[model samples]
Target: MAAADREFSPASSIALTVGSALLWGVAHLATGRRRIGLTLLGSYALLVATILSMVTLVGSDLLTLAVQPGWLTALTFMLLAIAAAWTVVIVWSYVLVRPDSSHPGRRIATIVAAVLCGLVVVPTVYAARLASVSRDVVTSLFTPSSAPIIADDPWNGRPRVNFLLVGADSAPSRPGVRTDSMTVASVDVATGATTLLGLPRNLQNVPMPPGPARQRFPSGFTGEPPYTPGLLNEVFQYAEDYPEVVPGVRKGYRGPTLLKETVGGILGIRIHHYAMVDMAGFAQIIDAMGGVRITIKDPIVYGKYREGLLPSGTRKLSGEQALWYGRSRTDSDDYVRMGRQKCLLNAVAKQADPMTVLNSFESLANATKRAISTDLPQNLLPAMVELAQKIKDTRIRSLNFVPPLISTAYPDYEFIKRKVEQTLADRPVNKTATAPGSRPQSTPQQSPERPLTLDEACA
Candidate 1:
């Protein structure tokens, strides 16, 4: 039989059918009179238990892969399963073969079992390490962690609303880290009318609550003293100084709460919920989703940044490339970057079809566990999923707070306050305000524009 064919056979049967089985038989006959050692038998049982666990994991993973069928994703699942099996086998074998008071023939059986275990383990471990690292890289680059927040609000007379998700990149390896993306999704329970608002990271001069001032030194300037209160971003730097508040992470803007409060103050609407995720989780989620397809109409090139280069135009983005797409500020200003971020988000939503997502529920669950932090309760998943299922792909709206309507040149603090005021008052938006240098005037033409495809807008 071919090696491949043999490997697929039942493990117990394989042990009995192969050349190794014949060898075992010969050894058994040679030691026929001797009983197996207690230590050896105990070790063998432990080894068996480990093998059983590995088999269970493999079976579970296989079932998961069947639901979510992507070649790369399936391969990753298999590799991890095999590696887990191998690790257990190695530990089992070591325990089984250790020197002990036993008959010489029993000792020989222990040795043989150890050798067999090693045969299965060594290669699996090596392969697993490589696969895991590669998968991690893919995840780190593509997936943005989104924490789901669900709440019933009497104020809005609605059952569900999603928060604008934000995650500060505070990893030491990252420099000049800032809020990478912001998105607000509001859903009406009765009509299921959903509006997704994508806010630019650099909308400038958003209204923030009055707080003590703090300055942010550029990343890696350990000696530079923190700044005092002035802008909202300054508060972020000040928050970092309070170790009790932020904890663990060193590079994040300290004032996430302040930022949230400021956003709420500006929008003039109470934000019912919030979620924060970092770049690492972001990439993982993307990879888990088998990458996202985005049409990039503009020729975007990041001149130089730690995030690296990206050539624009419709392209299939890996995790790393997607990160660059979201974080690219050099090619365009912050407002434009916000648009790109929305585009990426839309692409992710489009790609995450319910059937596909359901099939990869295990992977999605794993990714969610690793990357997301949310106030959303586990019990709400069924309702959320049901709501999401009803959402037609075409009906989803992506909104951006941009120039002509909202200027980036103004401090974000002021801009956000105006935005909140407008939102709370249920005022009509001036779409023409998006045009550069155009004053936002109240007019009948102020209805928001339909979703702009990348071809029309990005180009």
Candidate 2:
């Protein structure tokens, strides 16, 4: 009998080959592609081993980001595409090894292979579409501007990176934007320790350092009111309205640049970057996460001057309610609201674990993108991702130059600088909340400026 005739039918070959695809190389070995089969099997085995090892190493850090709605959405789509391509490649290789078969099953076998390939291709195309849509949403969310970036100094080699976080509130009806929340985050490069330095919006008489801005103000950015006009947050619009006042203000980023410089000088630390978000957008982000469920310690009012009151206890809050919860200055002061904001943050982080992000991926991504704007470049995203791993592992210490700590009215810049230095150097008193799950103390009842554990605050 001929060799071809001696071999089993095409059905047996197709069946066995299909089985080997699971192991990714068994089918090829059974069908006389020994060299290629072994090569694939070995390569796949090595890849699997390497991936397993990497997972073990990265571990919780991977979990931290993977659950994040923004990160997971992108990852899900990418994974689907890879899976689809891989399936097609495997099937094509199997087709090449099929035994010669004039048997009736040959056509059936070809049809089956085509069907399998189609299944993968369809999902791959769908995933690609989803990923593209998401990318568009993220790109469109922020109002792009020339960052007040110092040329050739990207903090690549620094032991620390600091950035200004501004909560910019601007409405169509309003003429100018107001920065309601302003906090500077200084991150330690080596250990991922983070220090949050909060600046009150009503701060006065901030000495403007020698720059293009000094020529105009000479002494400082004197607000229109001449005294209080130069509040920390007010400087943004001041710089924007009168861009010509600051000599070297970047074409479109005058306002942000000015604020960065003023904040940097006051804090006695160089502010390398800035990130801003609309308070309304922040509410949208909360709503997108399906409303953060939390134990509201007290009945908090919203909509300016006790316009509304959110009841206490464990309940879910809509975007508007959450926004009010964070920004409500009706019954409470700015510093008190700052504490509420921290509590909201802890609630969101605790509730929106990975599975939750996946479930609400679309809404969360849209809300966050619409709300957030930052000068931090896209190129640095990978680096940030790496740093986030370390950051999650390290304890985050916070210091707010609010209340008795530093007088916002008179304001001791010297004491503020020394405090910042000591905090960055790692203060023993502030050295708590040293876990990924831990949060900076900011409960409605507890002092917002101090670091209090969630348990302590809740208790």
RMSD after CA superposition, every candidate: 12.1, 8.3
* Top lDDT hit: 2
What does candidate 1's lDDT look like per residue over 1-459, in tens digits? 532222221333233322222222222222231243343344446756876886787653433222222433555566667545544544433333333345344455455555666666666655454345434533432333254434453224555465657755555664443555666666655555566666655544344444432122221112223532233333344455554434454444345555565555555555655666666667677887888787766666642444355555677887767776776667477777777776776678778876766556557656766666554433344344445555643355555666545554443333344544444334754432233333444432355444444334444
Candidate 1 TM-score over all chains jointly: 0.51
User: Candidate 2, residue 213: CA error in Å?
Assistant: 2.5
183 Cα displacement, candidate 1 (Å) = 2.4
lDDT of 2 at 302: 78
TM-score per prediction, in order, is 0.51, 0.71
Determine the C-alpha RMSD for candidate 2 after optimal superposition of all C-alphas. Answer: 8.3
Q: Can you list the residue pairs that collide in candidate 2? A: 67-354, 223-229
Clashes of 1: 41
Name model 2 segments beyond 4 Å from true. Answer: 1-157, 226-229, 304-307, 350-352, 426-459
Model 2 agreement with the true structure over 1-459: per-residue lDDT tens digits: 532234545676567556655566776666566787798788768757876986899775664443334664766666675676468556755566455566676777677666666666676666565565555554454333344433244355789999898888876876688887888878887778777677877776677767667776775556787334567777888888886766665754887788888899888899988988788988888877888886777788877556688998888999899888877777668887766665676677678877787677777777777787776664354456666677767655556667655556566566567667766775533322222222232331222245444344443
Q: For candidate 2, what is the lDDT?
A: 0.68
